[model samples]
Every structure is written in structure tokens, then in C-alpha cells.
Target: MTTVSPLVAAFRQASYPVGGHGRKNIQVLKEALHEFDDKLESDIYGTGESIEGFQAEMAAYVGKEKAVFFPSGTMAQQIALRIWCDEKGKRKVAYHPLSHLEIHEEDGLKELHQIESLLLGERDRLIRLEEILALNDEIACLLIELPQREIGGVLPPYEELEAISAHCRANGIKLHLDGARLYEVLPYYQKSAAELCALFDSVYISFYKGIGGVAGAILAGDEGFTAKSKVWKRRHGGDLISLYPYYLSASYYFKQREPKMGQYYKEAVELASLYNSCEHVATLPLVPVTNMFHVHISVPKEKLEPILVALYAETGVGLIHYLRESSEGVCSFEVSIGDAFAQIPKELLKRTFERMANMLQ
Candidate 1:
């Protein structure tokens, strides 16, 4: 395990830390496990009601005809791409240069499916309609991550999405959504999950992100697509003895927090404003479009660590302690708003930022 620095340790001990719901632990699993006792013997592999029912419920939520649960988004997405590539007879797909498959997956799609990825757009921006216009049907699918998290959780305008969708549909190109944080972007789009997902041919959503679940994913699409995914899932050995624990937690938290997305977005904008007020600190997007944004500080991580440690000690409210050096003499980190943000007293939060402004100056 990567050891957290003293700054992170101080933030952990702070009276109010402003990021995420809380430590992801067994409590998250317990939060949704009230109904299930140990004697549920009917559940075998994924035949349980929780697992099957969640897949159906999420299918409706995301406006798909059918859905299947996956142990991980990596497994689900690779299968989604493989299905598309097989149907289109092209072993190639396209997505952002910094796509999870491209950077984070250790070439799972390439090694497992023999599928090639045509990386689209610059490293620091959303893939534009023009980029899609330049591609032919040679690529089997195009994956768009809502609120491109790497670029500060930024999203392209809805109109741009419409144009891209139209072009992809007209070109025999399947559109896949990497919607790990799909629920987080709902407030900014001012659209329902179903409406937003309508633009994509297939969608993958994470339960652990903004939903505060234990861990799981849903791959949803038309009947034919999802049926194929189920076959691929079995081929990939995703069928565990029972996934009811993950399913129940995902369903529980989705109900608990889906409605709170707007509130989280409001908190994110407010939080970003406070960061912008501090010298040497800025949030990408200037204003957050969703419940998350990247915090970039114009100070080296080495120098900023002690300052934040001191701040956490002096102020009861912890602002931020984790830091990632974005460039020379600069550092960055991501913040996602949830239950913890509301727990921080408003007056203390304001005072903490005021102290931060002074310290950064």
C-alpha cells in the first residue's frame, strides 16, 4: 500500500475533511446488507434477485433495453469494445488519448481481445466532433467519458455530444459511454440519466464512484448487445459464486445518493470558488460543471505539504492535503464532493479558506 504523508494523515484526523463520502470500508457493504441474512441459499453464481434485479433496474435508469453486471468496469468495457469490434468486423476502436483502457488497463483490450485503439484528441482536452468527422468506419466504436475526468472532470457541451452521436450513427460507428461518473454529470446537463444515455449505443456506469457503493459496474445496451456481453462475461470468468453483496450495496447507495447529485454539484462549485480565492491555487474549469474538479496549486508538493499540515492543525476544517505535482513548482489533485462537504460547518469552511488565502499568498 502507498503510505500517505503526514499531510494526508492530518487531513484524516481533521474534524472535517472535504472529499468523498467517507473511507470505503466494510460499513459501505453493511449499509445495504440489512435485509440479506446468511441463509439465502437460492443465490448461486449471479442467479440471485439482487444481482439480476440491479441489472434490470440500471437498464431502465440508463435507458437501455437490457443490462449485465460486471465485477469491474475494466472487464465490462473491454467486453463492450470486443462485442462491437466483432460485430463491426473491425478489431479497432477509438477513445481519448488518456482513456482508462489506453493508460490504466495495462493493455487488457489489446492483449485479451486483439483490439487496437485509435486514440482521439489531445491529451488535455475532450474529443471534438471534428476529430470524429476525420475518422472513417474503420473503427468499430467510439467511447466518450462524460466529464472527461482527467481534464479536470470537464465535459463537452451537449450540442457537441448530439453532433458526435449523429455522425457516429450515420457512419456505422457504435458509440459507447464510459460513464463511471455518469450520475455526477446529471445536474450540469440538466438531463435525466436515460436522456443522456440515449445518445450512446451502449453505456458502462460505476457504482463506487459518486454512488458510494462497495464496488461493481453495469454494462447496458439493447437486448442483442447485452446478451452478447453476458456470453463474453462468462468467457472472461466474471461469474462469481454470488455477487449479491456488491449488487445490494450498489442499489442501496444509488437510491441514497442519486438524488443528491445536484446538491453535490452545488457544493463542488462552492468549493472550487474557495480554491480560486486562494493565491497559487486554482480549479480547472474555473467553475465546476459537475460534482468534481481538479485542484491545481502553483506550489511544489514538497513545500505545500507542510503548509497544508499546518493548516489542518490550526484550522479545525481540513481543506486539502493530498497533492500531485502537475509540473515543475506546481501540484494538483482531484476533489469530488459528497456527504462530507455538507458536514463541514459553513462558517468554519469560510474561515479555513480565508486562512488558506493568507497562507497561499
Candidate 2:
């Protein structure tokens, strides 16, 4: 563990948020809280009419016939796959090997739903059409995650995305989108969220990621699909007695942070390019398609951890801290930027990162 000196302690006090907190106008949250407080009656719940109102707005935003809110994307995604399998009378779903469903869900699809995954695509890189095309016809659904997160936020090109969409449509295979970071991809795609969402049969979006909500996710599809999912959601024990807080926070964050997405993309690209020029740093994909990218820096394992711990204590600059030990015994570190930290001066951050690299050498 790295010890924090007094100098580092002072720097920590001067650093910005490690998460999205005061990044927006205080009045926005004040009004949202006021609305939340006004609705804090007995049960603090919404009728179908009130729930439907929120659903309608979200559906229209994503160009879907209906939308349903769940406490999490995990439930929404599982429900989506279950619905797709039931409709098509198939048991297998195709997705990238590194998909959140496969890696993060603890085999819920297999254990709970008795559904199987085909697990197509490369693990370290973005999965392409040839990789997807190799799958057999037993697949009931295909899930595509825009800006694949685990692989350092890489994405398939626009034309390739279109080609895959076309293939799914012609084959009668249901397409489900894991759009947790869909908002971050729009500026580069030059398409509205609704337009991009229209390409899939079902689209799942998280309110907590780029939107900065406290917690919530919405799955949008045709009215029948979403209505069916509500039952599955209840079956899976996801129906909440009250959801007004999540709704209000989601709504507030959506309204406030959605506009800054374009600026974030610009800054991300600039930062990635800057890192690429440094001797010790190489950026994933060499450039960023969205506001999120990774800085892969080579450093010695012995020096890396202490420097990182010191940097965090000194500057609340929280970069992604993971070290992989190669056969040669070298360590690689990554820096990830989100809305909370994206506004900091990119040049200054890059300089500090380079200085850390020098210390390791």
C-alpha cells in the first residue's frame, strides 16, 4: 500500500468527484427532489397510468411501442432473452464471448431460464460479421452491445453494424441490444437514440451509466413484448412497490447530462490521441469511437501500485487500476474517463500520467 504524505492529502482535497455528483446544476436536482417529495405519499408508488406515462415518454425517445422499467439491467436483459426464446421456440442466444450476460450474470440464463448461449466473437477484440456468421441456426436471438465495455470500449463500424442488422432481419432472428452505453455512441453514429434503437427488436438501456441515475434500466420493444416482460419481471421478483425515486433521478439525469454527450466524444478523442503520442502509453483502438477509452501503459509491477495509490491519495484522479503480468513480468495500467472526470483539463491529466510513467521507469 502506498502511504499518503501531507502533500498528497492536500491534493486529494482539491480533486474533483470520483463519480457523477455535483457535475450538473444544483437546481435540477433540487426540483427533482421537490417533485419526489411531493409524491411521497403512502406506498410511494405509481398506478399503471402514471407508470405508463413514464413508459410512453421513454418509448417515444427510443422509437419503441412500449417500455418497461426494472430495478436493473440484469433483470431487463434476462427477461428480454426469455421473451425472445418463448416467441421463437428456441433455446440458444448468440452474443459476443465477453458480453455482460455471459461474464457478469453468474449463469442466470442457463441456471434459471434453462437457456443456452452460443458465445460467438473474439474475446479481446470487437466481434465482426464473419465471427457472428459462423454460428448455427439454433440461435433464437442475437445481442449486440454498442461500444463493448469489457474490451476497452471498442465498437463495430457503422456500416458493419448495419450489415449485421440486415442479416438478423432477413434470417427471422430476433435482435436484442444491450444499450447500456448507447447514449455515448450517438454522436459518432450521427443517429438519434430512437433511430438506432429502431434497428433492434428489443433494446435495453441503463439509466445509471452515462445518464447518472441512482439506479434503473428500461427495456423497450413492441407493446406486446414489453407487456409480457412485466409478467416475467414479476415472476423474477423484480416488481417494486414504489419506484418514484429512481424515476425522478433518472429523469433528472437524462435531462441534464444527455446534452453534454457530444462534447464528451470530442474530449475523449483528443485525450486518446494525446496518450498515443506518449512513449509509455498506447490507446485502445488508437482512437475512441465514444467518450470512453482506455490508456494502456507499460510499467514495472513493483513501482506501479505505490505510484497509483499515491496518485489517488494525492489527486482524486481515479483511473482504472488493473495490472496484468506478462511472462516478461511487466504491468499494464489503464485510465478510464466518465462524465464526472471528463471535464478536467485533458493535457494536465496526460502530463501527470506521463510523470507517473517516468517514476515507474
The per-model lDDT (C-alpha) reads 0.90, 0.76
- The TM-scores of all predictions, comma-separated, are 0.97, 0.86
Candidate 1 local lDDT, 15-38, one digit each (tens): 898989977779778767876676
Question: Worst lDDT window (10 residues) for model 2?
Answer: 39-48
Off by over 4 Å in 2: 1-14, 17-32, 35-37, 40-50, 310-336, 342-347
Error of 1 at 54 (Å): 1.5
Q: Residue 193, candidate 2: how far off, in angstroms? A: 0.8
Compare the candidates by lDDT and give the number of the best one: 1
Q: Count the backbone clashes (under 3 Å) in each candidate.
A: 0, 0
